[model samples]
Target: MKILYILCLLISTQVFSQDDSFAKEYFKNGDYEKALFEYKKLYAQSSSNINYISQIITTHQQLEQYAEAETFITELIQRVDYPSFLVELGYNYQLKKDMAQANLSYRKALASIDENPNNVFAVARSFQNHTLLNEAIIAYEKAMVLKPDYNFNLQLAQLYGEQGNIEKMFISYIDFAEANPLSLGNIKRAINDFISEKSENENNVIFRKIILKKLQQEPNLLWNELLSWLFIQQKDFKKAFAQEKAIFNRQPESLLRIEELAAIASNENELDIAKEIYIFITQTAQDANTLLEAHYNLMQLETKQSSKENYQAIDATYQELFKKFGTFSQTLKLQIAYAHFLAFYKNDTKKATSFLEKTLELPLSELQKAEVKLELGDILVLQEKFNDALIYYTQIQRNLKNSTISQEARYKVAKASYYKGDFKWAESQLKILKSSTSQLIANDALDLKLLITDNKYEDSLQTALKLYAKADLLSFQNRNDESIALLSKILNEHKTEPIIPQALFKQAQLYEDKIQFDKAEANYEAIIANYRDGILVDDAYFKLAELYENKLNQPEKAKALYEKIIFDHADSIYFVDARKKYRALRGDAIN
Candidate 1:
């Protein structure tokens, strides 16, 4: 008997759900009379269902039965003490063009909030639902004032923003952020809509003044952090550095934020400020790891700005660091960087090779060892020891299978094969790597695969492709002049080949490396004019746009090119960056 009872109950509940769904569907389809009939039936069965009651009222309003809706709401208010029904009655009056009655009903809802502050939630939400912004604001504020423990700053902030009250919105958001610190990221993202890259933007100025005034009233590290962030946004790294220093002075436990700011500055080409920040880190950091990172970054900055004459001094500084902090696993990155510097910068492969091999004797994780081996493989390839380099790369592949480093090692393996003119093997390797978890590696693999497949059959001997690969190898070895000349030969001799665009792009990069911006511009223009459908066209567009913006002082040209990427190549990897540059150049008020 109990089993039969359970089955009956299940069937009844399923019928109930189906009936409710049918009623909602009818309402959604604008079959109001049927919806009203179904809703009334459900309400008859479940008299306490608020959803049914609300839907009945809304359906009546939708059918232009405002008088009926108001009567039903008034009846509900008298039967139940639910204050939100007053809002419904007011909305019905509004639909009927009865402004006086609407105001009276809305005032009754606000008075309900005064009687019980907890009623503010439903009251304000109802007001917002009806697009009554002013009433919603009053409801929230009154409740918060009456009940000190109630907090509705987030809601108030949104309402103020909608009302174009920027100052009040900022204050409310900041107050909410102060109360709930973890929401800082969310608040900043919301605020990002109002500010621009220019520090002098009106909204930016307003926000800065607000933060400054708050800082004066109560000096908090959060304000300094925010100021630093704003300065970084404006590309004013010098001021950002000062703010970061103030933060570090007050809370010297970690240099992580300062380190991040320095990295941002470096990426933005603010090398002097980056160097200064790193130097501060080196001087003030108490931990060996922090000091080492600072020294390493400082050396990198020096290397970037240094000429051949500064190599000897840079080498001495490396030795000084080694003497201070002994060679160990902790200093592995510095050691690897030093090896790259020696091999690539100084062209001392023998010494660089020996140094890395010695460093390999230290205790390290497999991933760490893979990092060292990756660099060592590069040095070996630099020395033209292709087979030896393959051994190390294959070991990493075997040990750390499917990891990003493993994928990197596999890419190196394919690169090594390509450099050695083994097109078939390189293509095979690249084919497998097209699905690499890392987008960068996958893109690179696809590009190389396309390069080989496109040109391998162009000549019976594959002469042009081989020469192109050799040029690529030379570029990897930092022999930019040779690579440029070889690529020029490809352009001159293989003008009709599909490889022309790729060759031109490669040569343009090499020219840029040589500081020959005009030549680079010419090559990029060649690709854009002749090979609009080529895979490298978007790349050419972005590179040329960057050159125009930074090196050539042709902001108008840059803006035009960025506009192309924004509209034409939406799927290009450079789309986001292009859009950002486009907006910045256009002096957009918001990002």
Candidate 2:
């Protein structure tokens, strides 16, 4: 008997669900009378369902039967003590241009919240749904006052933001974040819509002042952290560093935040401040790993700024660090960096190769070993020992298959083949890597594969293609001047070839690195003017826009170029960044 009863219940539920779906479909298809009939039938079967009641009311309104909708809502209010029904009734009155009755009904709903604080949620939500901003705000505020434990700051903040009450919105958001600390990140993201990269932006200034006042009054680390975030957004790393230091002093448990700040500054090209922060870490960090990382970052910054005359000093510093912290797996990155410096910067490939060979003897994990071998392969490639480089790269692929490092090794193998002028083999390897797990590797592979397939058949000897590969190899070897000159040769001699645009783009990058802005501008302009239909035109537009904005101080020109990428090359990889730059240059208030 019980089993039979369960089966019947299941059938009943399935039938009801089907009925509800049919009602919704009717309503969606604009067959309102049929929808109303179905809804009434469903409501008759389950009169206690608020969804059915609400849908009945809404369908009446949709049919423009305002009097009928008001009557239905009034009957619901009489049947139950539900306060939100008053909002429906009031809205029905408002639709009929009876503002006086609508206001009276709304007042009754607000009064219900006074009798029961929990009604505030429903009442405020109803008001907000009806676009009654002031009533909703009043409802929330009254609830919080009557029930001190109640928290509606987040809702209130959003409502205030919608009303354009910026100060109140910010204060409420901060209050909500203070009560729910875990929501701080979400609050920052919400607040980010109103601020810009400029420190002096009005909203940014307002946010900063609020944080400063909070800091002065309460002296909380949360305020400090927020201040640091704001300063970082403004690219005021120095002020951000100050805030980070204050937090570190009080906490003293971690330098992670400070280390992250240094990296951010470094990425922003605030190298001096990055060095300052890293030096502080090296002095105060107790953990061996942290100290080593700080030293490594500091050394990297110094090396980036050092001239050939200062190379010996940088080498001495590297030796000192290795001696201070014994050569082991812990310092693997620094060791690899030192090897790269030796081979690439000091032009001592023999010593760099021998050093890495010794370092390979260290106890290391598979990934760590791959890291070392990858650098070794790069050094071999630098030495033009392409076959030898392939051996190391192949070892990594065999040892760590399906990993990012393995994919990187495969890309290296393809690149080495490309450099050796084995276009057929290179194309095969690159085709395999087009779907690699690593996006960077996939992009590189696709680019190299396209380069080979595009220009290889243009000449019987593949002369222009081979020359392009040689220029790319010179770029990898850090021979920028020679790379630029070779690309110039390709541009002059291979003008009619499809590879001319690629050469021009490549040379423009080298020119930028050499700080020859005018030359870079000319190269990019050539690609833009002559190769408007080429794949690299978008790349040219974006790079030249950045050059004009940052190097040439021609914001209008940059804006126009970015507009080209925005409107013409929607699928280009640079489209998103170009649009952002274009908006920032145009002073569009970012949201």
| TM-score (all chains, Cα) for each model | 0.89, 0.92
Q: lDDT for each of the candidates?
A: 0.89, 0.90
Candidate 1 lDDT over residue span 413-476, tens digit each: 9999999999899998899999999999998999899999999998988888989999998988
Off-target runs (Cα >4 Å) in candidate 1 are 1-62, 363-366, 437-439, 454-460, 522-528
Q: Which segments of model 2 are wrong by more than 4 Å?
A: 1-38
TM-score of predicted structure 2: 0.92
Task: Give a tens-digit lDDT track for model 2, residues 1-591.
Answer: 423533543565555665698889999999988899999999889666666777888898889989888888888778777788898899999989999999999999999989999889779989998899999999999999999999999999999889888888888999999999999999999988777777777777788888889988998898999999999988899999999999999999999999999999999899999999999999999999999999989999998988999999999999999999989999999999999999999999999999999999999999999999999999999999999999999999999989999989988898999999999998898999999988888988998899899999899999899999999999988999999889889888988999898998898899998999999999999988888988899889998998898889999999999999899999999988888778777776545
